[model samples]
Target: MLLNPLLSLSRSPSVLQRPSSLLRPLSSSNLPPIQGGSSSPSLYCRSLVQRLDHDAFLTSYFWPAGRKKDAFFALRAFNIELASIQETVSNPAIGRMRLQFWRDAVRDLSNGLPPPLHPIPLLLSQTTTPSTRDLTAYYLNQIIDAREANLLDPPPPTLTSLLTTLSTTSTPLHLLSLSLLTPTPPAYITSSVQHLSLSIGLTNLLRALPFHLSRRRAVGLPLDLCAKERVVMEKVFRIASGKEGGEGGLSQVKGLREVVWEVAVRANDELMTARRELELEGGTGFPVGKEFMPVFLSAIPARSYLQRLEQLDGDAFDPSLQRRHWRVPLDVWLAWRRGRF
Candidate 1:
């Protein structure tokens, strides 16, 4: 799978070095405490992910302890903040300003300083070493750039366009996560990560389609597929909002189910491609390495969502689809125990 090129920044090594003389204790003004009065940024990130990104939070357990896990949560927390902007803000200008703040915050991180009182940046600044700092900032900035473009809320014209757009939005975080594990990941590993990230991204779009439709946001579904299926967004919106009898009216669209199936199939295909890359010559399809298991394990929930979609016969608006899968934790634990996604 092809991945988007990451944006690179250049700065002097000395510029990244912190001045020892200026170091001072954090206070309420410089470091606002999280709810419940805890000042720990890692804890804040952990709480944020646990609340808004439960699947990622669960998969985080497989990452080895210490700085790697801290970096993992920080990246996820940053993503959640960006992803939530379009939904939370009343206007695009506000969303753009928030994304710009993150862009500047990323610059501060590269300069070896966390933006004041921001838990995610605080944790990121703490976790990054000189070796990892530049790449981390690059990855964060790439995500910010992609999300800033997405704030315009353009529906992709084709499935190819959708994947192209999502490749930048979703793929970099996986790459950054892998970078945290090893500066030089094997070629196969990087390829597999790209496939998995796209798979997860596609699956997430499917799951969120109804919610997006209800809000009258740009349909996350490709216009080509929607047109091929004769899917009317107005009807989809009516069904999602219960104006036309809710999910029970979904079948009235005729082509919507097929469109959803086609997208879900593409998502599954990406996951399968990743699996094929990891298969041993004459063994079970489990991957060979334990060190990268945490990253690979992310595919579990994505796969599970795709499977659930299949069971629902490609119905994207099923209420049950919005609920967390009760079996995800057990599935993740088993996958981790077996050393594969």
Candidate 2:
């Protein structure tokens, strides 16, 4: 499966687009008009199916037209919804409970029984087949594992430890899932997804660092290294955001932002390097020249957004940094419409 050349193309930036006003809270006018009939099993199932279709519509650009595209998107959307529950829930206990619910749902699906009435399970049922069922179970188990691991805020003793945790927590499931689904998943897919996931995850982590740092400070944890990483990360963010100056800003933060930037840069380079290596190996399903545009475009804006966060925060790390960096870039929208990198 790795021999397929088409899979070699980099994911385009266009794959990230959604309607600009979609993020706004639903209002009465925006809400669907109410109907008089009671919601039935068919109605519920149809609604869930529509959601799956909507998810495919939103992300189909990342995938070429094929059965794989349809099946993968359906499974991916379900995974995204399940994963979001854990991240969005404020209480760790509640998050764990939701994770367990998903775990059980996976088992039920695997047993040739339909999943429970939850939207995710309902959606999964529409796409379920014997071969895909195990894949779904594997993906859900990985999410559950990640959730369990995240319940505690353990400080890594070394950089290796941090990377090890990230690989185990964040990388494997997606890679394995795509690998299983695609007739042959190009090496670029794994490399790209890993790089993209790490970049986004780390960006989110950096945004939350201020809160973590404050908590650490209160308890008097030796945070010199953490502080330095934050400084480095901020520098990377600034560079990404098109801010003035370069590494010179590194000194201003006492190295906190420098540390963070170093982490992000290293992570990005690792992914890019892996991609290069994959491209060297007979080059997968599609030629890079044709496929790379979308991938590069999507990635640039995401990288820029992280950099923007650094600028918005200036020299200091702010707890609410994410909110400040939430706006989608114009390039991202353009890429989405173009549907190619």
Candidate 3:
């Protein structure tokens, strides 16, 4: 979900600019204690590290143990922080500025500067292997590319065009990162990441559709194209509902709620297909495909959330305030992680 002003206020620019706000006084003295000489870590940096550590512990069990696990955790943390900054900034311009800060930080890392006091950079520096520095730089560039893509409205129709737009953004870099984490690069890594990112973008687009349709808004996407996409999506939803299977006595309620499930199933299918293609392409020696398994499993939680919504709202299928319906993807992510799927 996009950050509103209220959410962004929690991490206001003023707070970010003030180093004092970021650090706690060690002794009740007016003078702040310095660590590593002119490189005292910020509270935000510490907190971010802690959060990353926690998330890593929870998710990294799936990863092979040792340095590989550590590297995977670090990369995952960096990606989370990068994505979070965009979602947390209240103003788009400020978000862009934060992203640029990241770009500079990445460049600085290449120069052997102690990681920036900022958590993301610090974590990235810690995880970066000498061999992977170039890959790191490339990945950082991808984040910048994604931010740039976000600034523009949705591009014109055609899957080719959309894929092109996505290629320039975070998707390909994410695929590359997945490739790096594995013992071997899988051919399907690119397709899987592409499909996953697109699935996420499409779901996000769906959530925003009602508002766009009602307001006649055309932010980065043409209304006609959006309409067409929605129609396809609706078909996708029906398939999810199992109505297309010709199973009689399937409750209409199931059909109504199938939109959420359909998205998940389609995303899973894309991921599986990508994995198969990668294996067929002689990329089977690497763990690249396995890296994306968790991401694909994320859909289970999304479907669960939809079920909860159906029970609670009962009228969740109605065409009203779709924006209000967005929830924490993490909730679904956690649930899926716990085998709740």
Candidate 4:
């Protein structure tokens, strides 16, 4: 992972030039603009989720019609809203203001009313009805908090730190989805979802390597690992940003492939761990996986992604990896049939 160095937004000339409207408080008079054109809030949220995050959209697409599927769309849309703030702004302070608006919106949702115009927060507010079970304010806030951390520009400085950050985002979404299936979650089910969430989240981040490299602020590889592997961040960024110098740019990044392989290996380890945890706990007590397939369905795509990355020799910036239409649904359906993901 090669990321841009941190820009000193506080003292930077650009921050002063950024519009004051970008930092205004969120209220009826000052609410930030939201992407609102669908026929209904649910339609808006579902389309936004599908359009922005196809991988996650597929997870909910297979789910049978139920309140749980609705919850998945609301949650996924909320994630996109927060994740896109940075992309939508020119300055870090502006991005933070957008995130703060979400935080305030979450606060408003807790008060039994979200902004009337926005779809994500309003849909999220609906998910908190008395019957929604363990989908609590705490879990939603955890996801928001994690996104808030990344709002600063550049990602967590190391792989270990990065996992810590992702655990908040992915783990909460997975656990909350499982919780929607039942009010009182089993211990093993909880543990397995947590592990699987990290696995899926890490894989999701790894797959976005190219996109991140092209961004102004690129996430750097873990310093110690880079030092040990003799990986060069500059070369990694150049190849990743498609400025590959035309001389096998991926190969140019000394030991970057090894770092990516280690990440893949760890993801594989977590996949196995999740399966083991589910079997050990759910197998002995109840048929958790069979009953709650959609909650765990994300793991299938995550696994399929790992398999594809392996084929590319663990090169995160492989040209083929960037190609759209990777038969993701078929892979997920196959994994679904195996009762594994």
Question: What tens-digit string does per-residue lDDT give for candidate 3 at 1-341?
Answer: 64332232223111111001111112233222222211422333334333332222233344555555555545554555565564455577777787777788888877667876665566567666777777768766776767655643444465445445555553644454465565354445555556655544433333433333333333223234445435343443344444454342212323333443444344345444544554565545234334455444433322433445446442333433221223333443444445332
Each candidate structure's TM-score, on Cα atoms with residue i matched to residue i, is 0.85, 0.59, 0.53, 0.81
Off by over 4 Å in 4: 1-39, 131-135, 155-157, 239-246, 282-288, 324-326
Sort the candidates on TM-score, descending order: 1, 4, 2, 3
Q: After superposition, how far is residue 305 of candidate 4 from its true place, in Å?
A: 1.4
Please tell me which model should have the higher TM-score, number 2 or number 4.
4
Model number with the top lDDT: 1
Model 1 gets an lDDT of: 0.74
- Let me know the TM-score candidate 4 reaches against the reference structure: 0.81
Candidate 4 per-residue lDDT over residues 304-335, each given as its tens digit: 77888898888777655654334556656655
Per-residue CA lDDT of model 2 for 1-341, tens digit only, reads 53322222222212222111111111223222322212233344333323322222233344444444444444554545554564356677887787777778878988888668665465555556676677666766776686567554455655566656556544554454454345355666656656654554444355444433323311111145556444344343454344746554433545554566655565556445545644555655223332333333334334554566556544334323323222333444445555332
Model 2: per-residue Cα lDDT at residue 288: 38
RMSD of 3: 12.6
**Candidate 1 vs candidate 3: which has greater lDDT?**
1
Clashing pairs in 3: 22-43, 153-220, 154-220, 184-286, 188-278
Whole-model lDDT values for every prediction = 0.74, 0.47, 0.45, 0.65
Better by TM-score, candidate 4 or 1: 1
